[model samples]
Target: MSRLAYGGDYNPEQWPEEVWHEDVALMREAGVTMVSVGVFSWARLETAPGVHDFGWLDRLLDLLHAGGIRVALATPTVAPPAWFYAAHPEALPVTKEGVRYGFGSRGAICHSSAAYRQAAAGITEQLARRYGKHPAVALWHVHNEYGVPVNACYCEASGEEFRSWLRARYQTLDALNTAWGTAFWGQHYGDWAHIDAPRVTPTVGNPAQQLDYARFTDETLRGNFIAERDILHRLAPGVPVTTNFMTALSQCDSMDYWAWGREVDLVAQDHYLITDGRRTHVNLAMAADLTRSVAGGAPWLVLEHSTSGVNWQPRNPAKRPGEMARNSLGHVARGSEGAMFFQWRQSRQGAEKFHSAMLPHAGTANRVWREVVALGADIGALAGIAGSRTMADAAMVWDWQSWWAQNLEWRPTEDHDARERADSFYETLYDRHLTVDFAHPEADLSAYPLVVVPALYLATEAVGQNLRAYVEGGGTLVVSYFSGIVDEHDTVHPGAYPGALRDVLGLTVEEWSPLLRGERVRIEAADGSVLPADVWTEFVVPNVPRGAEPVWTYADGRAAAGPAITRHQLGRGAAWYISTRLAPEALDTVLAAAAADAGISPRDDLPRDVEVVRRTGEHGSYLFAINHTATEAKVPLGAAGTELLTGERAAGVLAVPPGAVRVVRAD
Candidate 1:
């Protein structure tokens, strides 16, 4: 625990017995201190029902311990053996169309199945009792990415569980009916028996019903995790228990991490780059920031990321020279205990054989292997930052429940993507060199001088009041379109369009005017600068008397002359609202202005793509300057310091090489 943890998932069962020793040797050479084991070894561990085999695992753990590497022993519940599926076929998940999934890939079991739960609990108990006090074990990894591949299953068992969950949540049919708005299509559930999982429906099923189903699925999966976690807690006692989470919004969107964050002893996340021709490092920063925020600003780990190109994407391309180190250190700079990849050794067989790993298929002679060894050394040198917390200048509102509701069957336009808006806003903040902490809608915002809500389609009354109080307390607020339109139950707020936020924003959306694909519009700011926007526009009525000023007007669009963007001076602070999806450049201007309003000064001296973040701990403050551009980036330092990466003395200015990362410990 004194040093940063490195290494990745170690699947020794995939290789021959003789390779284990060599694997350990290579691990030591790569500076690996810890690894995750038994993630997909359920079948290998428990060969048949009522039978167990511990000889191999015991030997492997001993080998790892002897090699000075710690084990994050995982319960192989993610992929139950085929024998289990054969015995309890009902445990297999069924699709929304009622097709039962076969036991080929991982995460095939229905979380709500009693048989699966019992079996998973049994395996977890066995693992805990066997290795709870083992010297090799440092952490208990419950499952491999809880909500990946499949989040919800529409099986008969899930149906019954859904009804039970609804009973607990709503208490009665009338309350459930009202919450789900079942009276709309004369689809009121007269009894619990009639209610079922929101399966394939005639047209668009009830949005509220779908929304609740998403919640139910998340809770159900989390319940399985909790069941296993309880076993570990009871038996293992002190060792930290965690289930790696894919917190990056683009990868996984099932579990509400704010809830999951509170359950685990430590927060761990898996983030992979999306090679969609965007600023991927910005996404990496956002994911890291979000994970740290979920961990309550405590240091967390990058449980799984690609060492180079990932195999699952549409196109897999190897990383450029020094890119691997940059990616790993980027996460470390944002409060990660250390960086870890999906695997230590590349597989020779299996679905993920092509996936990049610490020890790639090209062996230790390639760029990946060399970088892996180099990154290990760098991580070791920066071990003093283990418990440090990343500093943030602003907070952004993000909620999985709201994202689920907004992603439902029908909306103003299919082009209106909440994740895109969030990404855009986060990217703008990143460009401004502002580190952001993501907050739940109802979380306290007083600590942050500025708060941005990118796309919160489902905003509870409490969230509206929270934002109002924040702005009234002299905090700046910026909200994008389609927010505050629906409540927690996915019900449209009564009265004005942006129901709950109307008062705080000082504007009412009369009607949404969504443009067709490829359609664009021009909005003229007060300074006569025209900005182009797309995706959507709204008929906005500003509360002029209440200090709502039209900052940007739709110059040429269906909502022409309407406020495209409005700024409301409420109490001692201000709230800005954007009624249309502005281009990234336009968004940058608005966000820059809002930042200035909140008394936040962006690091204007840094070049574009140069990210500067600070991590502070008992070891003193460390400033991380990452240069993503192809030229040297000069970062202005307020005090003299030594660059931890190279142990070079630096004062006033820190020059970061192109496509590299530098960390300076302030003297």
Candidate 2:
């Protein structure tokens, strides 16, 4: 149960039966023990009705178990069998625009279709009945990136299902009209039959309808996941169940799925952070932190990291030396129970023809194979460090729904890139060695010493009250600009800055001066601390400025020379006010000082760019000091340690060459 669960995505079903042994031989050399199979073999499995194909899988499992390899059994529900889709064409999803989708891809089945549910349940039950007790079965991988099917259901089944879903949500068209504001353009729906999914592609329609459709898509797919999970758990009562979730997906509020914490035994995630040559260090941290948050700070897994370019990406860049390892350890350091790659072997053809693989088609002599072994050995050497947790006393609440609402704004508009900015914030905290949690806006915030809310644009009155309560209970709240403007449905609150939280903050904003892109302004704390010209600056005009004070101001002291960032000491708890959007340096500086004041500690050992990954285990704390830089970097350890990568123990400071890794045990 405690091994790192090495290896990933073996496709024995794709190759000739004879080549299976060669694959087994290679697995041993790479120290690989787990293979995710049956991800897209639905058509091949059930060529006809009531005819189950098990001989291949049975032999495959027997051979793998003999070779000491475990199976991350996939339900193969991601792609419908051609027979299933053809027989039940109604299982196809319809888009908001009313166009029907043709099948030729994975995850194309309608998530809410009864046909899909029945077929998927039958397949899962069969698999469980056959392999539940098999010693080789390790974990159940429900579906492949459940969000793959870009939404649009045209089938009658989906149409009826959509109506039912809407009924449960709004109850009646009157309520729906109020939410959709249907009276605006004479678009009021007299009947439910008149209601159809949005077609915003080439037409101008209400954005709210489109947004709700997107949210509904998330729920529909979530239903599929729930159904598959129930079947998997019932069939194999002891096996852990999980489905890989793509992080930072805006089309769906993937974060919303985290509320079903019990349905998932482990929080396994898929990340494709590389679009250009450079890595998104902050994005990586956000993915890991969000994944860990669901398990309530329990260790999660990096279920899928590409060995190279992904086919779906507009631009696929091959991972350079140390890039894969650095990314792999990035998750491990942040409470990852297991770290695995997307695929062990490259496919000759398909949508993923060029997707990078651990072992290339050229066999085991390539640099890719060599790197795989080196990574395997490095992780294997550090055996007892997967379950460790870090020392963190603070958290930040991230609300994706609110994030979407901000993007729907009319004035002072810009991209509501919460995923990127939130990552920026989290990455800065990590670089400063701060233990940060990505909590929900609705979660109880009393546990954390300090809370940082970036942009809660769509937050409700209840959310504001919750934050107020947390602050009144002696907790510090750090808020940024452009927050508290909207309701849960992306509707404006008809008030000033931080609309709903205004009363709680005891301030009224009269006017706000937009700090144009690249515009600079001075920040002078009421305590007499001053910093010159920060990016994304703004001025705050508080209604009842009793204890509220400005921390920074412009040098010229213009006519509106107020605090760029203000704060108020309300009761026992403190509410920090920030007017301008801060640059990285400014945010790090201000947050670091605030963190120190709140008694929060920074545990990352190296400077920015030098990654210090911490993992928990039964043995002791394992700190992976990885030099992601091309030039050599030095890291100072907190205590005496041993290098798990090389079995080298050290005291004081440790120097890591470029692209090198140092494993150490805390004293």
Candidate 3:
């Protein structure tokens, strides 16, 4: 723990025994402090039922220890051996369409199957017992990404499990019926045995039922993880146990990190860029911030990212020169203990053969290998920042449950995407050089001066009250459209639209007016400035008695002359609401005004796309200035310091080359 953990997943089992010595030599050359081993070696290690082959792993760990590198020993339960599936075919997951999945790919086991759970536990315990006291093992990697590829199943075993989970949650069939609103469509269950998993139906299934199913699936997967984790904790007493999470909203949405975060001894996440032509660094920063928040602002690790391009995407392209280093350091700047890629050495033959790795197929002579060495050295220089906390100026309310509900079958418009809204708001904050901490809706808001609710299509009464109290307690609040419209049960809040937030926002939405695709509207501010908005418009009636005032009115739309944006003064704080989706520039303007009201300001002195963040801890303060622009950028430093990357003294201002990163240790 004295140094930042730098390395990637090391699958030595994929290579011959002699190749490991070379891997170790190259690892030392690249400054690899730690490497994860045996992530997908279940079949190799457990050749037969209850039989394990540990000789290869034993030699590998010994070699790594001799090379002065630590190991994150994995349980290798993610991909069970082919024998497991042959014995317990019932363990295979069945799709909602009634087709059962066969085992050629990973993560195909039904979590509800007792046979699968028992086998997974056996492997985990075996690994723990064998490597529990290994000197090179520094951490216990419970399993690979929990919710990747597959997290839900519709098998009969899963059906029974779902009923049990429901029984525990609702206690009685009557209560379940009421909660699920089964009275409609005459779908009420007369007996417990009648209830089944929300499988493919003639029409859209009950939204409440589907939401509960999602929750059940998350808990089911977490239960499996906890089962393995408990075995690890009991067997490997001192070692920390963790399961990597895909915290990026775009990548994985099945697991609720707020719930999962509390389960792990350390929070670790895997983030990959979507490469959809948007500013990818913005997404990276958002994912890092979210992961840090999941870790409760403590430093976390980048368990898996691409060294260049991944093999999965539609048009995978190699990262431009220096982009790999910039991408890795970007996570470190936002509170990662270290950066790690999906793999150490590229594979010669596999589904992921084309995936980028620390050592590509081109071997040590490639740009990837060279950059890998440089990045490893750079990370070693940032050892002091390993445990530091990344500072945040504001909190953004985000909940995976809400996202799940918003993505249900029917809604006002398919254009209403929670992730898009969140990305837009987070990107705007990023552009202003504001670090954000994502919080669950009901979490404490007193720590933050400003809180933004980007899109919460599903909000419970607790969430509304929490926001109300936050604003009343002198915290500034900004809410986007389509938020606070429904309760946890997917039932529309009674009375007006956005019912839960009406009182706090000091406005009532009588009806939703969704714009057609590609349609636009214009809103005019009081200063005679106009901005275009799109996707949605609303008929908002502000409560004058609540000290609510319109800041911008609809200049041309279905709600012309109506308030497009309003601000309400409550207690010593203010709440701002946007009744429509504002353009990015317009959103920035509104957010800036709200930031000023909250006594925060943008870092306008820094060049555009330049990210400036600070990490402070027992070691002292460190400033991370990452230039994402095409030209050199300068960042002001109030004091003199040593640049960690180059070991050069920095004073007054720090000049960062284009596409480069600099970390300064404040003196």
Candidate 4:
């Protein structure tokens, strides 16, 4: 009813026909109505170059279609077979050290290799020609998980390409040298021929050039993704095609990935958590809400959630009991159309052999299966609620491209960490039970009344203009440290730390110092209440704007001291500035007070120890009041609340147990 699609990845490629049949029954029992097939079938598709095999796949699709299951077809180019690798040796990506990969894992291919492009386009054309009209095909999944460039490919194609990339970036060696400060390193290159990707930092050279190269490399890989996506678009015109994305990934920024949105139908992201508990859970909720917002509030798929512990990380801890269901339901409540497990079944071999699955090694009777079945049923019952409920009047902003620029900084100090700052900022905001949207720094700013930009280390001139306009147009803006210091190339704008923002902020930063990883600096607020800076510390000299008020003071004992935090009027809007990371108490004290300053308030009364978020849709708003604590709690409400998940109703305050959730519908 709500355009809810059920089902997730199913790899029949791994099992016998008999086992496949058994899975169908089990899938139906779990309320699954669709399957994702062909995630790793390049080997099956082309046994040799130009050869195509649809025998096993055709049969599998026919069987699933007969059984009334839809398919989210996969391109399955994770890793090409050894024959293709041997046939086109240039296809292998050369690492930064000049070593080529021999292939063993997924995401091993050189995305830009001529061989990869040729083979990928051919496979896509064939798949589209064969299955584009099939009722069984629902969507197309591009290469899995995308990639990370841990190893640099120093091969010839990449080497030649790097030169071209530099040429496009600087155009002239003089400009390149000036931007890179090449004179400082004596490593000045006479021409493009003298430039090489920074390795070992062999001599005094421009850190900016090297960093830009890293960025160029990042963009190059992103180009490959676009190329591959274009192939899928041509092959499958009507079908929605998407590759799974990692949110806030340091190496591969998903914002750059969004540049190819014309080829993408919907946004799908993976959510994994650390073991510290509620922090991880709340973080995932914010991410899901943000992902949906990026797709213009459409329910984005939770591409591949772990059924249990992830095997890839250095330390893999299995999720605690009830954690999986709680997490899954959390996504649904926040506008996720569907939930999918990375693996429905357990792997018997390879690196992921021990990763958790819905059906454990013990088969169908295990608790995991029971949990899966229970969640499946609950989700089925709430089918009409999926993609139905939406957020209400509150406005919160999160930016993506700005996030990339923040993390790309190769800081001399430890301050280049954007994810850490972003996560902490998110946590402090979410803890207050406020619903926030992750806005791309470059996106339109006029829609929302309140915008938050954290660790804005990178801000393009255009981005600065957008922020100024938003504020001038009466939109409230909240910004944090290391902001507006650099451009897209990670080069400083040369004047102020917040260069483009100086005029709007009405202040100039004289000097700032980096604080220790967890050290705190105390700052007193306007009312004499002190706040702590726990992330990065900066001293601010406020040329205080006329309508702006200094809210927080510097914890750093300095001769010339004033408030490190301030709020002021810029046009019809208000601008709030936070110089550094503040402790939870201080951060909340400021943000909550800031919301009050902007005349913004939560749409509904809140619960004690429960963070409630409401998403407004065309019909009405969906309210999610979640219990963050372990004890039973009651959330305050003025009107009646209907539980969309259980069809239960609550009058007055809604009572919920520890770590439990209630999705309610209220106008």
Can you write out model 3's per-residue Cα lDDT over 452-500, one digit (the tens) per residue? 9999999988889999999999999999999999898898888887778
Per-residue lDDT of model 1, residues 1-667, tens digit only: 6678899999989899999999999999999999999999999888998699999999999999999999999999999999999999998889999999898999887898899988898899999999999999999998889877888999988999898999999999999999988889898888899999989988999888888899999888888888888899999899999999989989899899999999999999999989988888899999999999999888898888989888888998888898888888999989899888889999999889999999988788888898899899999999888788899999999999999999988787999999999999999888888899999998989999999999999998898999999999999999999999999999889999798899899989999999999999999987899999999999999876675799999999899988899899998899999999987899999998898999998777989899999999997999999998999988999889899889999998898988989999999
1-667 in candidate 4: lDDT tens per residue? 2335566678777787788878877887887766678888889888888888898888888878777777889887766777788888788777755667776766677655788777877777788789887878888887777664232456777667788887887789888877776776476779788777655444433557656655666676667656667766776678788777666333245434445333468777777765543466767776676666666666777777877787766678877666777778777777777777777778787777787877778898777888888778766766556556456333454445556444443463565466666666676667666666666666776777677776676677887888888889888888877678777656677686577677667666777777666566778765667766665556566664364467777746441266588776889888888877776667777778667756677434554457676656555666666676778878776568688657888777788778777777774
Go through the candidates in order and give the C-alpha RMSD of each one to the true structure. Answer: 1.0, 3.1, 0.9, 3.1
Instruction: List the candidates' TM-scores in order.
Output: 0.99, 0.91, 0.99, 0.91
| Residue pairs of candidate 3 with colliding backbone atoms | none
> On a 0 to 100 scale, what is the lDDT of residue 588 in model 2?
82
**Model 3 lDDT at residue 479:** 98
Model 3 error, position 8 (Å):
0.5
* Global lDDT of each candidate: 0.91, 0.72, 0.91, 0.70
Task: State the local distance difference test value for candidate 3.
Answer: 0.91
Q: Tell me the TM-score of model 4.
A: 0.91
